[model samples]
Target: MDNIKLFSEPIADATPVIELFDVGMHYDSGEEILSDVNISINKGEFYFLTGASGAGKTTLLKLLYLAHPPSRGHIKLFKHDLHYKDRDAMAKVRRKIGVVFQDYKLIETMSVLDNVALSLRILGRSEKYIEKNVPSLLHWVGLGNHMHNKPATLSGGQKQRVAIARAIVNKPDVLIADEPTGNVDPRMAQRLLHLFKELNKYGTTVIVASHNTELVNTFAFPRLHLEDGKLIKYNAGSIWTLFDKKGDVNV
Candidate 1:
């Protein structure tokens, strides 16, 4: 009922990186997980997605990453609508978006170099390019010498470093990370936050989903808060409402 259908209009010029209009999601056996969400994130903006456990924070990240279509609303990325986007089309768009999962989803069987290269190679990037980039990136994350080792050999923070490098190698338009620091020590977490800040400084739109309020508040960017599948401006005291003439748009 609102104008939030997600369709990318092309970002060859500067354009909003993400836009959600009247989006919602539900699962079988029947509870609504996310309902009527609307947000617009522009280039170089950093946002934190904050909510307690089971508040649908991760689920919303899944939607942004195109893991699932919204049940009723539109989801757009790079200015394009995405609800009916085909597998290949979606993959193309996804190539420009990086994701860091809370679980540190590094491939256990691969060497660190191989794992990091996998990200770039998946996007059809040349091996020569990956060879040059992975080392510098890993170095930035403090993993330069560990490239030949398997992920199993690294400590929690080291493993996280690998995940971060892999997620960012492509310099995607947007980086969506879920609890990226959950597995690291506080010191390492701070370091990684600075690294992400550096990435955002380089013009990557950054969205971090986490329960770390102290950290969220430490930075001044706007945040999205969710509870029981409903969303509102960060830490606000009321449910979102729509009073426009177009019928309550359901947020």
Candidate 2:
């Protein structure tokens, strides 16, 4: 792990790595999903995206991950305006982001090692590099003994770990996880959060989306709370204070 950077090192005092200004998204029917969303997430910060089901948590993540363009407004990734970046330009930035889908998105046909190694393979990493690092990463995620197993054979928690291993294997600058702990027990959930915390300490900007309020409350990270198509960005204590007053702040 020391030889390989598990995440990119942040530049000192640079602009926010992610920025959204007057962003909005809607379906073909034109009902807005996100409205007037504006926020800036700096490099190496950890944030939790929280909201009720269908409160646009996933939608917001899609925008961050460059899954789709917003129906309107501007987005900047690493200081490149998404609206203007061509396909290749956008892809160049996208590679720096690692996403852990809620569904685990593993290839059942592939062994756990290969599943985790696919990103490296795609990036043209040498087989030797893959062999050396992939197994080591799997071990870090507590999957050392199961590297040869396929996805179908893993327990829910194990599969989640595989997904996480795959996401971080390429050392993405930004790591986005949607309900990463949703399938695991309380103990495992805490363990998984600790892993994310460790990644943040190594300079990866991490954004985790979760509805598990109890788990979220235990952490002191700032939060981006979405409600009724708007965003409320607040720190730990600010959320409780805002909840009591039934108020919201953009920043």
Q: What C-alpha lDDT do the candidate models reach, one value each? A: 0.77, 0.85
lDDT digits (tens) for residues 1-251 of candidate 1: 11221123333325677888877788886788887777777887777788899889988999889888888878778878774548878888988899998889888999999998996777688978887777777777778789999988999888887888888877788899999988887788877788788777667888898788777666666667776676656423344343343222221
Cα RMSD to the true fold for all candidates: 7.5, 3.0
Clash count in backbone of candidate 1: 7
TM-score against truth, every candidate: 0.85, 0.91
lDDT of 2 by residue, 155-218 (tens): 9889999999999998888999999999999998998898898888888889999999999989
Off by over 4 Å in 1: 1-14, 83-85, 235-251
Model 2: lDDT equals: 0.85
Residue-pair clashes per prediction, in order, are 7, 0
Alpha-carbon shift of residue 56 in model 1 (angstroms): 0.3
For candidate 2, which ten residues in a row score worst on lDDT? 240-249
Clashing residue pairs in candidate 2 (N, C-alpha, C atoms within 3 angstroms): none
